[model samples]
Target: MTSAIGEPNAIAITFFLVFIVLSLGITVWASRKTRTAEHFYTAGKSVTAFQNGLALAGDYMSAASFLGIAGLVALSGFDGLIYSIGWLVGWPIVMFLIAEPLRNLGRYTFADVLAARLRQTPIRIAAAIGSLAVIAFYLIAQMVGAGNLIRLLFGLPYEAAVVIVGAVMLAYVLFGGMIATTWVQIIKAVLLLGGATLLALMVLSRFDFNPLALFAQASDMYGASVLSPGRQVSDPIDAVSLGLALMLGTAGLPHILMRFYTVPDARTARTSVGYATAFIGFFYLLTFVLGFGAMVLIGRDAITGIDAGGNMAAPLLAEAVGGTPFLGFISAVAFATILAVVAGLTLSGAATLSHDLWVSVVRGAKADQREQLVVARAATVLLAAVSILLGIAFKGQNVAYMVGLAFAIAASANFPALVLSIFWKRLTTAGAQSSMIVGTVSALLLIYLSPTIQVDILHNSGAWFPLRNPGIVSIPLSFVVAIGVSLLWPVASEARRFAELERQLHLGVESADELT
Candidate 1:
């Protein structure tokens, strides 16, 4: 079947080939140094703040942000701004609450931080499950997005596209480790931001460089009612719930948090986050322009008739603005964006399974670096396979919806434990464990019983779980469970140890050589 945008342009294909080669070369070069598990997992804790910041942007701005947000804005006007605000607002929480403590406490994963003041095995197991669940959901979403984009741009079969993405992403994580993945994200971020800026400028230029007029025109195009803040829909409850998930979810994400570990110290971690916030905020503001650009310039009828997935809006707008060559460039950029994100997710998942679960939990402190890297590589391949299968099974579903589900789970399961582990003095092993379990299980069960799963997955239309996202209910539930469980089973020994570790995590810094 031919793509709605016509055959993939040769320029786009050529650009894609060049990217694939460059990414592969970087992976090969980085793999040589990935002899130790520390190098493989955290890039030897050597990445600078600025470099890590750009890479963080690359990891954070997945296909959902790049393609999904623009499409949502083009489709729903102010409703799309909700996603932008949700995503952008979460960074402040990371910068102030989570960043320094996370950097100070953890060695490899978020599990490292939470389990620092708790038992190693059970906490590691629970956190690993949460991390893996979130990672798997995220990976599936990226894989599905990649397949759809490939089909849209190049007229490839869905299976073939999934295979290609899987192979490339696997190579990236297996050979490159954090170093290769970090560079890939950096390059992709630069291109994505550059392309978005260009597109935003072109869009603004179309209205003679007037921002107000552009919005006014967009309001007219989408309808004057849409311009009103509360005019789009009657139900703000679900909107609020979804927003909570996206906003808090960003800080809780394993991949985003893992980026901080690669940097040198808490100060650099904070600096990197600041830079990421600025970069991401600027980019999201441009998304508002680009979204409105599509609404007014491309028109609703033209885009609605295309794929309903909404991933194609940016590429389609590029074609409308700059002809085939520019469209090709945007398409190639989108493809590279998916590859970079998948690499990050896969690496994080592999680290959790290999380092936290296997070496740290199963093997204890006795396992050597060489043994851990081997387990990490094996886990990487396994994760890639599962994601590819899920992607193929769930093709053509809404990318944003799946990604939102992942966020909901992350916010519910990971956020509570992480926040409490760092700040609350009364937090015990029982509290952290119960919170993780309740949050993870409750969110998953809620999703399983949701309308999407019942109607779409089970082919039963009558089932209704009114809340599309579980964040509203499950987040509070997690906190409650943690606190309640802690009171019921108080551990004075655990509490004292937690206080001491908290002090060290907040103030103590080992020598640079002590890290490795």
Candidate 2:
């Protein structure tokens, strides 16, 4: 499965290039249709319900979910299912609580929703900061993953792989905008599902098409413990921390939230989540088949030798079952998976800077469509540069946990603000601002003091914060702060405004202009 020293994988390279070229072509086509802030940020709000659902699934299911979770399953066995379950739980909550209100109230970003009822200035600033921070962490992790996966798949150097990812993703966002980004996600999701499905069938055919037989074989080879729990996480507190993060994180993810705006209305937004939930839940189940298949068929030694973290389990499984050709196809799908996700993240970050910060804050209501478009493109360039740099800086890092850190931050910072804005009425502008700022700062601070940082980065014997995931404490802490601030320092006018937001939330009434 390993390549000769520094040699290129021509099969993988050819497939990778083909996917990139095709995605760029889609970008060119989308660029012709892209105009105004609406087109750039929300794809002109014209995406159909089912299409937006597929795009949502594509955007939400990153390389971490595809490669990292399967690798985790291959490595930790039953404990890996915890990660899958935790991630899937968040979608139901999104479908029920957040998606509809977000679509009804917001035009572009989550900031649109929050700033709908509150004072625009502080809400925009706080939300913009939270969005950028989430995007920074999430984007860097995906870019780092892009570097590693490409290096392994196509034999590119880490820097070159990262740069290629950065350059291409920037094009998708800069020119084609949300239109190009949404299509790229849909294409990648289909390829990933197809590749995963075929790989699963190949594995299952070896054992009479019964998944239990595959598990039985894994249990026999690796011991019954592999089919049981408590391997990677034995501590209840730490497990809860990770669970809370995964369960609540999706509702807060800006790129995922931004997808709702691409669809026409609140009803469509809810329908898209229903579709995404089905697609994502099915994909996660397939990962179990793929991961267990890797365990029984490929064996631990070979899988570890390829990747210590087992991130290559899925691709290598394709190689094992269908040989080099299938391996090349699956690897290219992984590359596309990374590219589509980072494009979505970069677009969200650009919106934070251009839509929220530049047009809304700096230029105020007077900002023209042309100026907003120019700033968004400029922000994309700036974000792409930063993403490339961070990707290089964190070379060889475990991208799954890097993504987990992102989820923890999202759960802590963005979730509370968004949920409270929509659900709780007495939330003041100052209260929302403090909750966001506090939640963001607390998550980052606790993460730095956490064992993941203390032992891994700081080389310390003991961590100031014992948990790797901060959500057990941070998520509740954020809700408490937001609610506490709102009740204690009630703004009478904002509370009066709550009746209007309630109308939009319950009746699907369109929100009035943000700046007005």
Candidate 3:
């Protein structure tokens, strides 16, 4: 997929530098406006619904979506489309179940909503840990993708590329916080959609603007099996498990959930979700065109000859169809995708670290905005270092698979507690904490025992856990653990407030905001 591996594409590298310079320019502009913790965390809650929608879509569609899914579809056909379907299906659930209530309830972070009535310290600790776990896995995945893609496009060293990504993301989050991050995401989203539109058009024009013709050509070249489900999800249980994680995980992603608070009100939050759903769903559909186009137009042998993972398919397709100039544009868009996503993830980690753990938990909410802002930037730097190290360590791994694991963990650790705390009258502080702890531990343990970590990473043939995804087990267990623990010893104070929380969940800011 990467024909110019050792040979640097000067045009692509030039465009890459251009995008980086422009993005850093955004950071500088945003820093002028970023002042308090509110600005740092939620962009002063000034983002309009449509803008936040674009930012949400941008932050959500990372290198994993653009490159990883396209490559998967290029290589595995119908099986790769499953990832797109699963990823997009989650948006509606997030809109109906999470967006409005989450925005109204949480001022900055989702942990605020989860810990609203519960004991702040315990809930914050548990929620912080859960948020951090998701961010850690996701950051590494994006960083790994960044490293590989940069090396492929620019001929840069993998470790150096990862560090460059880390450093740039840190600068964005540290100085401009959510404001810079949001603009970066919005810009990236626009560029990605635009670039993908052009690429898809170029691919479709070759087949007389007929998708079926493209598929027919692909079938002629690859065979009928290429249009059918393949080895990626041979196990029905694994498929269901993965679907569960993707559908539920959107409710839990810290960065995505945090976007809700970027808007002004619950109604705006709802509006943002609608816009985001449309944009994200549209983007997912275009990926099919890009993926199938790569297969039929670029050919499998050429793709695999360059990068066996097929990650180079889209960029290579750009080069084949549009020459080095278009290749440069697409490469820049992919890099922008990685930069925007990693910056969003890093910001979420900072919010979780500083706002939830440091201010709310450690300082008992007495820490001022200035102090919190300081901590947030410090945390961003710390997270950046961690991301670089992990990205280097996880080089050559499948970015798509790593993202799937991240979704599973998010679905398990954060989704259940957030849902129950909002809707269940019987939910107690102990229940939420225990559920998060058990969900996180069980998910990590299952992954370590599963083929993903054991056989894939450790090269051990005998993995204790058969399925690569632990969501089907871990998600339900989280709900059960919460229920069981709450029933065993309910926190009457927290349980009693469920009536008000429930009222707020249904109403707009009047009820929900006042409940806090």
Top candidate, metric lDDT: 3
Which one wins by lDDT: 1 or 2? Answer: 2
Question: Which model is ahead, 2 or 3, in terms of lDDT?
Answer: 3
Candidate 3 — which residues are off by over 4 angstroms? 510-516
What's the true lDDT of residue 292 in model 2? 92
Tens digit of per-residue lDDT, candidate 1, span 1-516: 123375757989998999999889999999888888778878988998889889999999999998998888888888788888889999998998999988888888888887778887888888988888899889889998999889878888888999999999999999889999999999999999999999888888888988789999988666785555554334677777887888889878999999888988899999999989988999999888888888888876667767775667788888888878888899999999999999999999999989888888888856777788899999999988988898999887778878888899899999998998888878888889889889999999988888778877788865657667888889999999988888888889888988778666787477434432
Look at candidate 1 and give me any clashing residue pairs.
none
Report model 1's TM-score to 2 decimal places: 0.96
How far residue 174's Cα lies from its native spot in candidate 3, in Å, is 1.0
Q: Could you tell me every candidate's TM-score relative to the true structure?
A: 0.96, 0.97, 0.97
lDDT of predicted model 1: 0.86
- Model 1 stretches astray by more than 4 angstroms: 1-4, 229-233, 455-464, 512-516
Candidate 3 Cα lDDT to native: 0.88
Residue 49, candidate 2: alpha-carbon lDDT: 88
Tens-place lDDT per residue, model 2, 433-459, is 988988888989999899888998779
Give me the overall lDDT of model 2.
0.87
